[model samples]
Target: MPVLLGGDANVYGMARSFFEAYGVHSVAVCKKALPALAHSRLVKTAVEHPRLEEDAVFTAVLQSLAKAHPDKTCLLVSCADGYTMQLARCREALAPYYRFACPAPEIVQSLGTKEGFAEVCAAHGLRTPQSVALPCGAPLPELPFGWPVIAKPADSPAYWNCRFPGKRKVYLANSAAELEEILAATAQGGYRGAMLLQEYIPGPNTALGVVNAYCARDGSVPWIVQGQVLLQERTPEGVGNYGAILTEPARQDTALLTALADLLRQSGWRGYANFDLKYTSGGEPVLFEMNPRQGRASYFCTAAGANLARPLVEDLVQQAAVTLPVLRPSVWYTAPWGVVRRFCPDKHLLGRAASLRRRGCGTCHLLAPGEGPARRAWYWLRQGAYWRKVFANG
Candidate 1:
């Protein structure tokens, strides 16, 4: 069974994915009981603890859980950055009992930060948003980019550790004073890492591209999927999370796909890796960042007929050769149709979404087989709440 970390839509999606493949339930360790995991048949165990992100507490929970269930092989999977880093750091201690699907500790430290990822992309031929990484608590340096730049902490886990009056996952600074204000607030929150000030590419959410790939034990990335986000979560906390994807290869930037595959192959990265990118007006895809594990919306790959659960099981559990096809032309929905329509104003994609559903090429992560009444209600309620949040923000 996969011992997943963090309780959210992504973890539930992963549990459902594992259940669909092996007809077995998985375990989850989260800080709170989120709606997605409530009354779900797929999640056999949901462990909640406040200090789950702390190093000692994280290891103890898994080690205790492993001792409790020695009959089954426990695979450690992370759905959040803190868990992913902690799992990679504590791999040696947990190797005896639990199996891991994460990269090495060094790789996690090297590429986990935005500046570190920018360095890797620069070494390769990948295009990224032209900006600078300025050290926090220092005098704000002259930015290479213009006034309207994207700002966020270079490190995710570090940023999550601190609290402030108004802390966002990302910020768009339309002026120099706004940039200074964001940086000041971040430094005041006790984040000592560098801040990522990147060029803000202009486009609707539809211009964003998402990639999901899995590299096996051997240095081979057999499975890959590139998707164009049709609808995105518009709230501050949920920004950059893809709610609907249109996996039409014609619209996706293939060069980004090739560069990413090469990055995984040459870097010797194993397990699932997902990339977030935005397309420039010149039609080039600029990479935003990378997740060491599969992203929150990875179920889109499963919906596109390229199930992500099979490859990991084949390579790790079965020790068999793994090969799979890419995603076909389809619209994968993880949100309700009303929510997707409410957030996405593009007439072209709205029409495409409608036509695709009529022809039966549309697939939903929540609408899969075997969902119970409670989960069914949570799905709609969660989407409704998300819709209201976005509406209020506007």
Candidate 2:
């Protein structure tokens, strides 16, 4: 049994990956019930534990679940940064019963914070955006990189918990006044953490790329996956979510893969890690950030015929030699047709998306035979309304 933590589209994608790779149903655990997650045929059970913030409560919940299923081998996987840290903090206590994949608590805390990640990049002499940290209640420093900078939370999960209108994952400030305005708005929005002012890598959206690797404890990576971001959400709240992704075998570069793999190896990282990068005008890819777990866009890797979950399952459960096949060219588009048609600005990308659709490309939502009638009905009803809103707004 694989227990997935987090109930967004990313968790849904993981459930699908595990099911497709191992022919086993995985359980999804979330703080609240997500209708889309409940509709997934791949989820065997949906567990809701609302008080996960409390360590004792979280431990009890996991203890009870593990106690109930004594015979089954369960592997715990956390997709969200908060839960990853939670598990990492308590892994020592839970090691006797429940098995999970994550780095140490310190490692989790270090990589999850933007400031810590920047330090890691500097240690490796890796290329990353020039950035300045704006601490809470401090006077804004002189802009080092100039106008049109990107402002974002130093700690993403903590920042996201704050609620306010016009709050975005990444804020673009084209002028000094706009930068001050956004900073004031964010402070009013209740985000007390430091804000990162970064030099905006100039280019179209196509310059963004996501790369991943599954590292073993001994610093060996059996495989890697990379995806080119074609389309992503443009809304304030939905800013960083990828809506379309593509991967190809020929596109893999040894140097790029090694650089990312070395980051994992040096950090003693074990399990799935996804990196976000943007290319400079001269074609050099600079690291933007790293997600400690499998990213929402990980389904693109699975679509490319390299399911990342397979390696984890094999190494942890099956205890077998994990040989893998080469990744083939594939694409995944999660945006609704209405949203794509209305908001996607690139007509060339639209043409390519259409071509991929015509060729029967892989997708995140796979409503197939044997799916429960209620689940299927819920999927259609929810997705229809979602598309309707997207179309209306677009």
Candidate 3:
């Protein structure tokens, strides 16, 4: 009986890769919008319900799969927060039919809200940006920090109708006036959820590292690996996401990993989760956020030698003792031309090109050769359009 994996198509790629590497048979069920003939068995379902409507869609999909393959033991892994929460909401109905791999519902809820995670970090004596939360339609609060403060929603797109229009969604407000203007615009755009007003911390040359781990049924952090983001491109409002390169774990990443493990243990986190952190000027790790599911950086982390998805699936299916992988130091670069041409037109772009020219990093576009030429062309075209949107707003 092949394992059943379902979620956003973005995650299907990694899940497919994991099963392929392990020589395990599996099937992928993805949302209808991003449809492709599943090179493997594919089930198309509607996965675009608003937060409140997600549980119904998930339950429908699972019930469909169970009826089709009664002999298979399903293992559910969700990539998006909305889907994860929906699964948790229907845990009683779904868990009996499938093995669900996710952090505790409370932990997922806590990490889903930026304000909630900040409070958790503060309670643990972890260093986080000073933040203020404002409800929708409320008057903008007085700017606590000067210009370039970080502004983002506390609940992401879970509760808000407005998607980050462009890079302006998450801003480095240069002045109180700029912050107020952006806040007012965000509120007027139907952003009714909580928003975070935080002090900006700069690390221009810094790489964002994600530390992901799988906790045992008893809540022990058994498998841990860290990977660095070589390149990142986000919308101004921070809603849009783009390609990233996975690289080998950095030597400086150990302390941060330890700190995060301790923090999650203290918070009673179990199952798979990731931490987004960057080093400060003094080499101290600063917590940015926690993702209680597989992250965008999961690809990079797996490419760097630790296949997080496999261990997660193994734990969920077999309940076997987990072990971490020994990863080598290597670099992965993503859609460099797009990133360079857009965000780093001057120094950053040139610097990356020069580095690649010097054989300092390995590069691969996410689109693979096995994909149809038409699909590949469409992907690049869509990618070009997204970058254009980012720059036009800039």
TM-score of every candidate: 0.92, 0.92, 0.82
lDDT per model vs. reference: 0.81, 0.78, 0.60
What's the C-alpha lDDT at position 35 in model 3?
A: 32
Per-residue C-alpha lDDT of model 1 across residues 1-394, encoded as one tens digit per residue: 8988878778877887888778889899887757767878888889999888778888888899999987998887788777888888888888888876778877876676677788899999787888788887777777777868899888787786787876788888899899889898888889899998898899988888899888888889887888878887666676657778887656555666677889888887878888898888788888999888888888877776677788888888888888675556778777677777777768788788778777887877665568788768877787778677767978
Superposed model 2: Cα runs more than 4 Å off: 341-353, 366-370, 377-394
lDDT by residue (tens digit), candidate 3, 60-146:
767777778787666676656566666667878877778776655677788656777888888877888778887766777776776
| Model 1 per-residue lDDT at 82 | 75
In terms of lDDT, which candidate is strongest?
1
RMSD of each: 2.3, 2.3, 4.1
Q: Regarding lDDT, does 1 or 2 come out ahead?
A: 1
Q: What is the lDDT of candidate 1?
A: 0.81
For candidate 2, the C-alpha RMSD (Å) to the true structure equals 2.3
